[model samples]
Target: MPEPIADFYAVIPAGGIGSRLWPLSRADAPKFLHDLTGSGQTLLRDTWDRLEPLSGPDRIAVVTGRAHRAAVERELPGIPDKNVFLESEPRDSTAAIGLAAAILVRREPDVIIGSFAADHVIRPAHLFDWGVRQAIAVAREGYICTLGIQPTEPSIGFGYIKKSSELIVEGAPEAALVERFVEKPDLDTAREYFADRSYLWNAGMFISRADVLLAAIEENRPELHAGLIELAEAWDDRERRGPVVDRVWPTLEKIAIDYSVAEPAAAAGRLAVIPGHFDWDDVGDFASLTKLNSHGRGNDLAILGENARILADTSSGIVVSQTQRVISVIGVKDIVIVDTDDALLVTTSENAQRVKGVVDALKLTGRGDVL
Candidate 1:
């Protein structure tokens, strides 16, 4: 193992609109900006709460769109205003993460950086920290390491990582080489992966040195790498950055980090996977939210906000009424009712994933206010 780096930096890609949890999660206030759970804090704030301990208060940075920069800052205090990288437009995950990697290299060439999505959910802070520490350990050994959560069930929503063989690294005994990354499989394939215990749900959390990631991006997507370098050079200069960014941002390739770096790096024998032994959930849609909010009252009824305003009579489902309006359901089962001030979403839990389709329809109808 190589020498361990003491200074660690955490980057959060917080640009998603979370269309699956629409109405409550709008363009102005995305899902990460609001507390979908009863956690008393927003998801972005919760992400900071957990990562701030592993990486110090000043070492964390968030890469978001220009519209949400101020909201991200308001949620996270003590973060230097310069640490936040505001992208001019929406590129995919690759640009959001690559920007942070390029900036960290400019600051410190050897700094270890880990990226965690702002919309996921993890529990028991100590356990989450342990997984991150192990990932950093493997990452120090010149491998792009990702935390792989053991699957609790056969979930088709998440992509999977196939664990090939174990690796010996100091401070991390449970790390293994990632054989391959599998896309969301069918029901039969998902069940086989779970039963055989050869797959772990990719948490989309990755750790590596700043230089390592930059080199990979340069090797895979040279065009994006060139643009990112130009932006990073002007990152400190207020006068030149805006002009350079406006010119280069939209022209960069639109690709995910998994396609641009991780899958290719795994082919080249430069990727590793650390088993995350803690509880994790992606909170992808209303169904996941319902599962996370279940407090042993059974899954019959899961109400997120203001239970006093909900009336369930011979009904079993999930209801989220943000305005605290009286929501009455009669003789309904497995139905999902989300009532906002101006929009209402009514669907079944089984069709929760289709909620994104509703968002698409709203866009076609030019209902930007509710979207």
Candidate 2:
């Protein structure tokens, strides 16, 4: 295990219903609450485990929706009640992470805060730790740093980061100046980027000094910064916290941290990126879930769940069963069957990305009870 960074504090943004991984992931119980990887641990627990070595259990905090506070607390008993920052509603990543930074800065001014997502999967723990160490080195120098993953394939699922030049930081030798962040592209554009070695997958992992992050937010989104500051002021106050959050939480602008801070910082040459040498996956959809299955690599079928009784003869793909159902596949290929107690989703891996549309249609049809 790598030595813990004394000033480093880790924050996890654990919102999002993960609509793409529907049936298996729901509104009341999001994907982070379940063990999607078949690793016998929920993604939230895995995330806490990953950060514990670096931040220690006490230095880590979690930001989640108000509805999920009890579940998240149940999953992570090591996290203190004070560290579990609950949002009244989903205000996107900017407000969620920014509030944590603002509140943490009040507690410890010189804190180096790293905001990591709660549901992403990263392999070869040592490499991730090293990447974070390097990011911390760069972050201490006052630049907003993000860990960028090397593109293993021309995957359009993730955003790309363009690195301009090498940063001559002492500890972070491979760190580079970020030119800009690009959205998920088409196949041709993704291929072009893959051919060029300057681009990396933006994993949405950011590490920075708490004050520096707040300043960047202040520069780009003054209104949001002001509201967050106001909320942070009353955050620890027992008397004023409740009334203030109820009044100000929903009024804050619902924007991603990428748009609110990262892009602007990149434009101003204040963004740095350290290339990560570890394998990463956001597990966005069932297709991604197929890839994360360790036993499904070369096999015709991959099965998730202890009680899942899937008998596939020649079918190739993934099958997830949350109940005691005997699911059998004959000759279908790339099929995805997610069988839960309340919902059953049957689709192909080709249409896995379109599963979110099903959730949208369900909501439009007033079938949110199943969602």
Candidate number of the best TM-score: 2
Point to the candidate with the largest lDDT: 2
Q: In candidate 1, what are the lDDT values of residues 1-371, reduced to their tens digit?
A: 22223668999999888999887788888888987678889998889988988887788999998999888888987889889899888899889999999988898988889999888889987888888998898888899999999999998999999998898999998999999999999999999999978799988999998889989999999999999999899988999989989999999899999999999988887999988888888788988887887664554788877543988888777888878688889888878899888998999879999999999998999987777
- On a 0 to 1 TM-score scale, where does candidate 1 land against the true structure? 0.96
TM-score of 2: 0.98
What TM-score goes with each of the models? Answer: 0.96, 0.98
Would you give me the overall lDDT of model 1?
Answer: 0.88
What is each predicted model's overall lDDT from 0 to 1? 0.88, 0.93
Per-residue lDDT of candidate 2, residues 96-171 (tens digit): 9999999999999999999999999999888999999999999999999999999989998889999998998989
